[model samples]
Target: MGNRTAVIVACALVGLTVSTPAFADSPAPSTYGRASYLLDESTGKAMISKRADKRVPIASLTKIMTAYVVLGQAKLTDKVRITAKDVRYAERGGATTADLRPGDRLTVKELLYGLMLPSGADAAHALARTYGPGVDGFTAKMNATAKAMGLSNTSYVNADGLPARGGDGYSTARDQARLAAAALRNPTFRSVTSTKSRTVASTADHRAYSWTNTNRMLDAPGSLGVKTGYTRAAGFNLAFAADRKGRRLVGVILGETDSSRRFDTARSLLKWAAKHPVEGNG
Candidate 1:
């Protein structure tokens, strides 16, 4: 086996303790869909891979990309009006909402909190309507940014990631991982996702509303920030990252059974990755 793989196996056996154990020749869980990958931030190497290049529906995890697009185009202090067009009629009933009303005024920063913390589809639409010229216009910008970032397999349709009539919103595990890494580069993006609770002050028509992050893993001590997504078609999708002893790891698991299981898998994967310290800055 390769040295890094051998190290990971040894660490897995001994529990990442000081005394490494003999490498085990066992298979890891193969429970995932279209694509999944674990990235070693220190060496910029993908330690595990499965269909990393295949584009698939990513659900609300697409909001992270939405945040990236909006943060670049608008300032936090800017005020946005939540229009009717921004809210999606939830025929299937998706939770994690800002519950924005028409003409309610809020700062771009708070809207970001709404988007990242609650996975607010309304907030996503608000940003797109304001800065994207329209949804299609904003999607164009998203694709352009993806190309710039060398994400050849990524594409976005609706800003809220509800999935279009045909196959529209799509991304690969590798693409999502790269996007998460890039999003972390922006201090604003990192700030919003890492925070557990956000309280937006009352607007003229509404009282203060507190939104909690959807990613349960953030409740853990070392987790920095990440996004989660789900749909009947997409199953359970999650993008997760954490820091321990100054080392960071990002992982994605697509198509799981339940919400808690997805989060648990994320925590487990992150813990495992944390155990194997990569070369250099790890």
Candidate 2:
């Protein structure tokens, strides 16, 4: 119940923990990203923070919020009609798409897979235009959701985190972890994110739209659903989660150096957190 004991307990849960300093109260860990944060999902306790407050590009991890807003505003069974403008916008942006095309009618549930799994931008565009009035309106709703969440270091320039003609999206690691925590609370969001592979039947013509999760961290034990992200500016950003026994933890890393490093860093952090096993955090 001492403050010193509480700090030590919290750090262990974050993983990549710092040893108790011989002369100082706190010290930073070297084995982390340019910005990183880890949280105990069950309790909302911050387990780790390294430059977690600095804002930076978040890439496809922005989809977590995109999916969040979509699920809140639309029914999963509602069918949405894709437009030529939606397909063209996504393709022209060089975004990783789900191969969705104009005339493809898919349910909001299917589109959720398109957004979370494979990190599809076309899916994001379709959902935004259909559910959001338009992409701008959806993005505005995303910002409003961030505001309601009290996220000071978060903003959405686009639904899929792709660069617009003007700018790309950005958020801090801490803010991102907070976003992931809120998102994972949704059973639907959690279920979709954790799914490794799925085939959705298009409402257009019953064509199977198969997709896979982009989060390699799922290969790790106790892995839960979250999201992945990348851009030249954001590097290999990732928002990941894992559950061990009953303990759940969320990890957010931005500006990682490469693809392999992104998953490796997350795996190591979560594994360490699992082995360390913060008390009462379970």
Candidate 3:
């Protein structure tokens, strides 16, 4: 493992603790996200909080729960036949997609790449229908999974995060940071989210598909895995994590108004954490 990886592992050996945003010197610059949070894994302190608890539409970030529920209930090797219904759902929603076509037989693992890296609404449908009694059952599991994880503010009406006419899933930065922390605890979820790109061959027929991760923060230094989101209702959102100097940090930014700004804010969050270095407890 690289030196940085070693530091992260070591930092994790001690329990997580969060210090107040008391900086060693000057406070970090004002941030931009409607809800922004920073968790300093070394001290376990919430080093930054800007409306971290205000509930708002969460967009595709709901997929983290979708992934968690599926991973808990399905085997990665299980073969799931893609269906016309799934593709059709994707067509109507205007969601980001990995070009999943009907009749492509993909494994659960392959579908996860579709579900996460490209944020495929079709892949979400496939996993939900295959694992749950139906899409409704699967979405119930998503909410149940959220509650079980202590995500009180989170709700899910769809496996993908397309808002229902009356309901778009809403979660606070605190709840999402909690969700991301839980997802990272699952090795498979962590590995998949951190991967920048993947090419998986359909086990049933051998057709291949490739996907790239949606979180641009993954390209930044010390960046790790997590997830991203966007919608007319949710604006641009991102849940991001990183490892630098053996410490792990989790950041969440919701409702950033646009795509590029979400990334710019996320990078700024990390830089702010690095420079501020929370110090002096009350």
Query: How many residue pairs clash per model?
Result: 0, 1, 8
- Expressed as tens digits, the lDDT of each residue in 94-183 for candidate 2 is 989887868978888888988888888889999988767888898999999999999988989989898766877779988988888888
Give the alpha carbon lDDT tens digit for every residue of 154-221 in model 3.
Answer: 88888888988877778898888877877787889888898999998754365678799988888778
* Arranged by TM-score, best first: 2, 3, 1
How far in Å is the alpha carbon of 104 misplaced in model 1? 0.7
* Residue 161 shift from truth in candidate 2, angstroms: 0.5
Kindly provide the TM-score of model 1 when superposed on the true structure, using C-alpha atoms: 0.86
lDDT of 1 by residue, 19-107 (tens): 22222433333334556777766567665566777778889988988899898988899999887766653223464567877778889
The CA lDDT of each predicted structure is 0.76, 0.80, 0.79
Runs of candidate 1 with Cα error greater than 4 angstroms are: 1-31, 88-96, 280-282
Which residue pairs in model 2 clash with each other? 14-47
**Model 3, poorest ten-residue lDDT window?**
10-19
Off by over 4 Å in 2: 1-32, 203-207, 279-282
lDDT of 3: 0.79
* Candidate 1: C-alpha lDDT: 0.76
Among all windows of ten consecutive residues in candidate 2, which has the lowest summed lDDT?
Answer: 19-28
lDDT at residue 192 of model 1 (Cα atoms): 84
Give residue 224's lDDT in candidate 3 (0 to 100).
75
